[model samples]
Target: MFKHLKSDLPSSIVVFFVALPLCLGIALASGAPLFSGLIAGIVGGIVVGALSGSSLGVSGPAAGLSAIVLVAISSLGGYENLLVAVVLGGVIQLLFGVLKAGIIGYYFPSSVIKGMLTGIGIIIILKQIPHFFGYDADPVGDLAFAQVDGRNTFTEIARVFDGISLGATLIAIIGMAILVLWEAVLGNKGKVFKLVQGPLVAVVLGILYFVFTQDSETWGISKEHLVKVPVPDDFNSFIGQFTFPNFKVIGEPQIWITAFTIALVASLETLLCVEATDKLDPKKRTTPTNRELFAQGAGNIISGMIGGLPVTQVIVRSSANIQSGGQTKMSAIIHGFLLLISVILIPNVLNLIPLSVLAAVLLLVGYKLAKPATFKRMWDLGWKQFLPFIITIVGIVFTDLLIGISLGLAVGIVVILIKNYQNSHFLHIRKEEKTGQEVVKMTLAEEVSFINKGAILKELNKLGDDSFLEIDVRKTRYLDHDIIEILDDFGYKANDKNIDVKIISERGIIENPKDYEMFFNQEKKENLKVTR
Candidate 1:
């Protein structure tokens, strides 16, 4: 892990910059103490990073869980009570890991996964537009279409036009230019460029811009558009920030229910991020999902025991880490330490940095994820793959992350069922036999399930009178019981239609076989196992 120290260190700084505002914004959105988000970010990066098998993934307090946390905090009567649920959620995640449930992530189709990445990219760009112009009404972490501020994702964009800050917009434009120039021209030119990332420079300049223009009436970047880190006045006050869980309410049924909900949601988000991060990784390294679950469980448990919100693998930070050239988990761990140290030491200086500069950094990240080329590539893959991909992006943009993924998965399943129904069997009409009748052959697929029943039955019912029908199972290894019953019924009706039927299988051929069930039963009894 240390082999990539130079790369990981700079990457960690970019991730740190990406993560700082998110920690505060998500905490503000969740109605929890702003310090709690920092704690979760710290625990997620340091604790989870230390334990997780993921090399590129960065864990933190997620924007996705803010609503859940908000409701749970109020419903449970206090933040302390909600912490109990978070701890229990971690335990449940551990149980899930022990059961090897991480395999669930693999079941999602590539189309859905790619859609998720692109959807998030579009969302990032959409959500940050307002902030780019200094309209900071919505929290930076809110990803859902309907926001807590009563204004939705799109309305917020329109709202920004009414409240654009000259100072914020100007600095954002300059910061964006710096980022583009550094990435395209100077990023690889010298070791110094790599050591000091473009984002770090943009943020420093933003702080300086804010400091120098504090007295200006027209060009001043206001405090509302700046990064907000909880500023503790003294060491004793900093210690007072940590809140312990109230385990006294552990007996309540609602607490248990909340625990299960958090566990399920958090695990799912982590698994999905794992998949997305691996795809984004240039190395294409696969993380151990079960171990990731266990690591996340441990992180959440520790985070909740203190004053932290729940933690999960976050794609935004992970993508930042990868895009900035992170090669190992050390980058994540270092970011956590940066969060911890910054809050303890220079939070005042942190609060001086402008949000628009950070927005510029995310804009670049968003463009990388949702580039126009990706859309064309997916479109070229054909409808079978493209439908789900497009649907996932739309759903995510209009709804939330999980809902979009669910919609994509549903479409993918429908496509599979359609394919299965159509490809169950192949029908061939050979030249007429010497008996002056047509010969029809139906070859079953390698595996036929109940889904293929209708197709097989339709073909069987279409047999012409005085025709010779050949049922071929030579390549089939498994046939469903429904299909067997259909073939058995067809065998009994063949005489009425004056159709001659012959069944061919690995087991010897049968001529005009009327007792199809018995023949298959005998085959099963002898352990041939060709038909169900």
Candidate 2:
């Protein structure tokens, strides 16, 4: 760990910069106290990082859950009552880990996953536009098109123009320019600038602008346009920021329902991020899916107890960590500590940083995730790939994350079933057999399911009179009961058509010497026994 500190320290600084605004933003999106988001981020980084087997995966409050959290908090009565559901959600997630439900993540198609990343990217850019222009119509993390303020995504941007803050707009442009310059030029100059990320520089400049331009008549930033971390004047006030769950909600049915929803959604999001992060990892390290569930459950439980939003492995933060050269979980843990220290020691200063600067930071992050090159790449792969990708994106943008993923998965399954229906078996019509009879040979694949029933039945029905039929199952390892029944019934019909039938497989031979049904259902017959 010490040897990797040189790498981890810089990566931690970058991740810290990335995580801060997100923590605040997600909390605001959730309609929970802004401090709750910070606590969730801290716990996600520290507790989950300590418990998880993943070396590079970072956990935190996710934008994907914002809409759900918003609804749950309101439906459950308030934030205090919702905390109970968060804790219960953790218990459910723990059970999921014990039940080995992590494999659910593997069932999602690649196109859907890519679509999710791209969809989220597009949402971030859309939601941040108002903030970048200095209007605070919505919270920083509100990704949904329909916001709590009754303004939709597009309407929020439109509203920004009506009450634009010139000072904030100017600072945001300057911050973005500084960031662009840092990445394009200054970053390549030396290790010092590389260690100091663009976001950090932009934030410092934002703070200076806020302090210096307060007295300016023409260009002055307002309090609403700045970061809004709660300032604790004393130690007691700092402790007061934490809120505990009300266990009385345990008796409520709706509380249980909300708990289950969170557990399912959070587990799914975490598993998906784990898979995506592994793919992004240059070392290709696989995170244990079950352990990840357990770690997330624990993090959520702790976060709920301490007044925080639910936690999940977040791809955005994890990707930032990887891009910043994080080599181990040390970077994640360090970022958590940084969050803790920053909120405690520099809460006032953090509050001074302009909201516009954070918006600019997220704009760059969003662009990387949903680049034009990515769309072109998906399109080049053909309709089978592009359809699911586009459907997922459309669903996510219009509905929500879970709905989008479900739609994409449904499309993917249909594609698979169609391919299976087409390639169920191979039929070759022979001109003559050894006995000089018109013969038809059908070769079964490695595994036969009931899905192949219609295709197989149609081919078997086409045999003409005085024909020989050979059904080959030599490559088959598993045979469905329906298929076996289909073949048995076909034998009786084939015999009436003056067709002679034979079955060949690794299990040896069965012929329609008599009723084929007897051969499979023989009580004590030794003749039809498997050769192996």
Candidate 3:
């Protein structure tokens, strides 16, 4: 992990900048103490990163869980009680790893996963718009369709026009310009450009801009636009910010429910981050899902014990980590330590940086996740893939992340069943055989499920007058009861069409079967069936 120290160091610096505001923002959104978010970020980086099999993925307090955390804290009586749930949640996640439940992440369709990344990208961009304009009524990282602030991404943007801070807006614009220029122009100049990342440069410039603008008599910048790191007077005072969980809450059944909720949601979010991070990795490294679960569980356990919010592998930070050229887990670990040290040593220095500048950085991150070209690429793959992808995108855009994913999964499963139904039949013919013609032989596939009903029904309807239809299931290993009932129903109608249906199996061929289930089950037991 330390082998690429040169490459990883720069990346860690980038991730540190990207993570700072988000850590604070998610904490605020969760209604937990602001310092708790920083604790989660630090532990996520150091503890989870050290243990994680994923070299490039970063973990931290997640925006996705803010709603759950908010509700849990209130319902559980207080933030202290919520910590108990977080600890229990970590234990549950550890059990999930032991049970090998991480494989469930693989069952999600690729299109849906891609859509999720794109959806989150869109959400990030929308959520940051208000912050970029210096409208900070809503927390910086809230992603819900509706927020506790009584507004949403669009409504907040509308409100931005009324409450815009000129100072913060100007700083954000300058920061964004610097970032764009660095990436688009300066970075192409030579090796020097490659050595310094645009975000780092933008952050440095932002700090200088803040310092220069601090003299309101001359530059006219307001203190409200500046970063709001809580500054304690002394070491002892700063240590007072830490809160301990009330262990007495552990006896409550609701606390356990909250714990399970946190565990399930955090695990899901982590799995998603793992998928998105893998896609973003330049080296295309695959993360071990079960190992990641274990790491996250351990991190959450530590975080909760330390009065932090529950931790998860967050895609926003991980994406930033990849974009910044993080090459190994060490980058993640370093960034965590950076969070810990910076907050302790230079809370005032951090406060000098404006929120708008951080917003600019997040804007860039959001754009990369939901590029327009991604939509076109998915469409080119055909409807089977594209439909679910679009559903996921639209669902997430208009609703919440989990709902959109569930809807997309449902659509994807339907598509899969339709495709299987179309392919289930052994033969496709234009016309049935003529009267007394050589028997029209049809075979069935190995495992016939309920989804194959339509195709089988259509094929059976094609038999001609005075024809013999040989329904062969000799190779079929399993036949659904629904299909067997359909066959039985077809037999009664066969006489009207002057057709005879014959079932061929190990029990021997039978004409015009009376009891379809008995015949099928008896033949299934006796026949050396050949699966199609």
* Best-matching candidate per lDDT: 1
Estimate, for each residue in 1-532, the C-alpha lDDT of model 2 and write its tens digit.
Answer: 6678877887888788778878888898778899999999999999999999888989999887888888888888999999999999999999999999988888788888998888877877887888898888777766676666676887877788898888999999998898789878997899888777777888889999999998886798988888888899899999999999999879999999998988998999999888878877889998889999999999999998989999999877887788777899999999999999999999988889888888887787777788999999999998889989999888877777778878988998898888888788999887863667888899987767789888898888778889988888777655667777788788878767888888886656777457467654541143323232
Off by over 4 Å in 2: 430-438, 507-515, 518-532
The whole-model C-alpha lDDT of candidate 1 against the native structure comes to: 0.93
Q: All models: lDDT? A: 0.93, 0.85, 0.85
Q: Weakest 10 consecutive residues, lDDT, candidate 3?
A: 428-437
TM for every model, in the order presented, reads: 0.98, 0.91, 0.91
Better of 1 and 3 by lDDT: 1
Cα miss at 238, model 3 (Å)? Answer: 2.1
Cand. 3 Cα-lDDT: 0.85
Clashing pairs in 2: none
